[model samples]
Every structure is written in structure tokens, then in C-alpha cells.
Target chain A: MSKLNDWVEASPERERIYAQEKLIVDTAEEIWEAMDKLEVSKAQLAASLGKSKAFVSQILTGSRNMTLRTLADIASSLGKKVCVRLLDAHESNAWQSVDAVLISRRVAGFAEVEVSNDPRWSNVIPLHKESCKAA
Target chain B: MAYSLRIAHAVENISRNLLVNLYINSSQPMDEYHSGSSLTIWLWEGAEASWAEAEVGVMEAHQAQFRARLARLAEFGRLRVPDHMNSEGDGIHAVKGNTGLRAYGWFDRVSGRRAFIISHVVLKKKQKLDPADLAKASARKDSYRLSKESK
Candidate 1:
């Protein structure tokens, strides 16, 4: 009956829930990557874990907040273990030190060559700059 | 006489460095208006997942929605978020999914182009963003800017 132009904005509570959802998604991805490395499939993983393919699919898509028991079961089946750490302020400093060196290296490397050679190309190219003026 | 030659050589070195910096600064602006140059996404060392990898880490339906939102961000030069989602004028933008997914990052201009650098990904269980997460993102933005300047 009603048509909305943009997606509905999230409430504070919804934001929190989405945050949890993101965690499940990230965990699911890790599990998927492990399966890939181990050369396993959802069907294979399901059989090994004595679970159903549908359940595995749900887990991978973050349809539910998986219990630690389920996660441990999945990890153990895949020859892995779950390690959780709550970092202290000093310890968590390591997370913030997301070394941008790699990114900068890529940019600077390109700049060294491109900027040095052409002396005209921008260090980074803005998308939609030519078409849109506001940005 | 020998000292004079050495002094002249030192002046030449300083001048050469200055010229290089000037040349880089002058040339970057002209290329800004060119079409077809795509935006760049940089992940941190420990955040070692390709954008595709990160995309696959969510629900099947949400993945498409996430991508569509990203497309809008690229088109608009900034990702859209509810006004309440912003972190107090810190330039950080966030997108919240109806399902459980939130992406947070800040925008930085590189050579007149905007680069959206993600500070952290959160899985919330509470009603408010952890102040620490905001700090982490802000720190990352600062580090990125500092690195850019040093270059």
C-alpha cells in the first residue's frame, strides 16, 4: 500500500541486533573459509557434524545466533578449536594498529610510477566526480 | 673553494626534493574530473578479508542489499545512514540492515577522491555503540591521514 524511497532507518535496538548479526556473519565466513581450505562442502560438513545441510546453510547465512556448543561442534568437526579473547585496553591497542602500510604501499607504489611518469594522474580517482557535482 | 662546491651540491639536493613534491602536488588535481576511475577499499592488516569475503559472511538476501547500498555509496560519494547513526560529526558513516548487519567507516579524500576506510565491524548486543569502537575508527582515520601526509 505504501512505497518508500529509501530503506527504513534502524532503531537503536535494531542497530544492536544488527551488530550481533554481523558477528554471526563474520563467524560464519570463518567457518566457510575453513571448510574451503579443508576441501569440504556444506553437505559434507553437515554429514560430518551429524547435522542437516539446511541447518548448515542457516548457520552460514547467520540466520540464527549459533550457540557456543554448535560452533565448537562445527569447529571440532573441521579439525579446529574456538578461541575467544576479551582484550584489555593495552591488549586491544593491537587491534587499532591496523597497519595501513599495505594500503599506503599500494597507493604510494602506484603514485611512484603513475605520478612520476605522467605527473598528472590523481593519487586516487574519485568515483562519480565527473557526473555528480555535490560530492 | 672546495667548501663552496659542496655547499652548491647541498642546495641542488634541497631544490630537487622541493621540485619533486611540487610536481606531485600540482599534477594530482587535473586528473580528478576524469571518469571511469573507481574508488579504492583498503583493509587493515588483521582485517584480512577481501570485500567479497566479507560479503559472503552475511545472509544470502542481506548480501544483495549490502551490495546495492555500496553501489549507492559509490555513486553518491558517501554511504547513507540515518542521522542518528552518525558518530557526533566525526565523519564516520554507518549502514544498518533490517536484519542484523551494520558497517561503519569514515570517508577521506585522497587526491580529491573519497576513500571509505572501514575502522571496525561490530556485532552489537546492546542499544548503543561501544565508545571504544568509535575511538578505534577515529584512530584508524588519523593514522591513514598521517600516512598520507608523510607521503
Candidate 2:
């Protein structure tokens, strides 16, 4: 839905991809459990990556200034993966059912999220997986 | 151009309270403050989900756009605004910045200094196909791999 005046466009695919960064970072930390969640602050990530703290800070901020090599290492260190696929603008909405965000929520029972246009809203019902009870 | 936004009333006291039915915002400050006619609405105040997860390219674009807007407002010298302190039509006296749209004459909306996710915004009224408006459109956009909401 292109709004001539909205001044904002939500590429369901891109937005969905963007949403994935935080989730990946957070979950990857969980996989690091015993070592104090690694506490890999920008300082640590920088030391390990042999880059400037400021540079690491920019990367952590998800700025456009990242190199694929850096991103790959971050992904590798975090035990995650990165994939890039191009799709047309019109095809974004149809992707609703398969987006990783909604998929993860469904699997985790975090909440059932709906990404829609007409009313245009997103909702996550925090709940326990077993009983489907709100947390 | 005049700008406006629709946001949680709690935006006024975000540090003190939780917003109803929304993701936990990363505590990003709305950046600058200014004035308006009736109430003191904020600009860049609604960086919500999109901007937080926006790519760096998008943020740069927004920054460029914001700078252009500010230059225009600076030309007028004193922006007319409704004053909260005065009963008879005193507002924020100000200029506009590319990022500070809708945030006329006001102050202190940005939250949390460290670990902030940068964001640019769009008011509901001024919304358009402009990529800058959605730069930080959603906090949900910029999730680290495998990270879930507020994990």
C-alpha cells in the first residue's frame, strides 16, 4: 500500500529482515549461556574482531557502512547465518505467512503476530508455550 | 511543511511508564524538541519499529533529508508556536531540522544514552513514500539474528 502522503514505506520483506537482526543477536547470546552470555559488548566484539570500537559501534548500530566480511564474522561468532534474497515490492505482503519473525513466534508461543495493512498493526501476545497463557 | 504524529500519550513520560500494547521501545530519545500551536508534540519522537531496524543506508538518507528541512526553517528565524506558559497563543518558538520534523519547539524526548538504535521519523500527517520517514520505522526491523522481541 503506497500512501502518497504517508512518507513511509514498509517493505514487509525488508522490514521483516530488519526485525531479524535483534532476534538473531539475542538468541545467539542464549546459545552462549555458561559464559555469562559472553557479555560481548561492542568493546569485546571490537577486540575480537580487531577493529576500532567506534567502527564496531557503527556495525552494532546496523549502519549501512558494514563490510560483508565483518557481518559474516559477527554471524559466525553468534552462530547465526545471513542470507540475501531480492523480491519485488508487490510481493512483500504475500510473504506474511512465511516470514521468520512470525514463524519464530509461532514456534515459541511468544505470541501470534499479525502483519496487516488495512488497519496496519503488529501484536505479540507474550505467553507460555505450554498453556498458551499470557505471560 | 507542518508536521504532526499520533503516538502514545505516555510518550510524554516514557521513562516513568510503560506504553500499552506495544513492543518495548529501545528507549531512543526523540532527539530535539520544539513548539506547536495547541500542544508541544515531538519530532523524530516516533522512531518506533521501522527505524530501529532500518539499514544504515536508510538512516543516512533520513539524515540528509532532515538537514535539508532544518535549513528551510532556519530561514524564517523565529517559528510561530503556541506557548504552554502563556494563555493567549504562545507555542514553541522554533525552526525545523530534517530529523526534527513535527517536533516544533519542545524538549527532552530521547531516552537512554548508550546502546541506542538510531532512528528518523514521520508524522502521520506528513507521511509519504519518503524513505526517510521509515528509516527507523520499527524496532522490530533491526533484530540481531535469532533474537526475539526484548529477549
* Each model's iRMS: 14.3, 18.2
lDDT of 1 by residue, B55-82 (tens): 4556545644443344334433433233
Best by DockQ: 1
DockQ of 2: 0.01
Q: Give residue A38's error in model 2 in angstroms.
A: 5.7
Q: Model 2 - which docking category?
A: incorrect
Score chain B of each candidate by TM-score. Answer: 0.58, 0.22
Cα lDDT tens digits, model 2, A1-135, are: 211112323445434443344233222222222123345566666676777777754443333355667667765665445444444533321222122233333321222344343321221122223423222
Estimate the lDDT of model 2.
0.32
Task: RMSD for all candidates, in order, please.
Answer: 19.1, 18.8
lDDT, residue B125, model 1: 49
CAPRI tier for the interface of model 1: incorrect
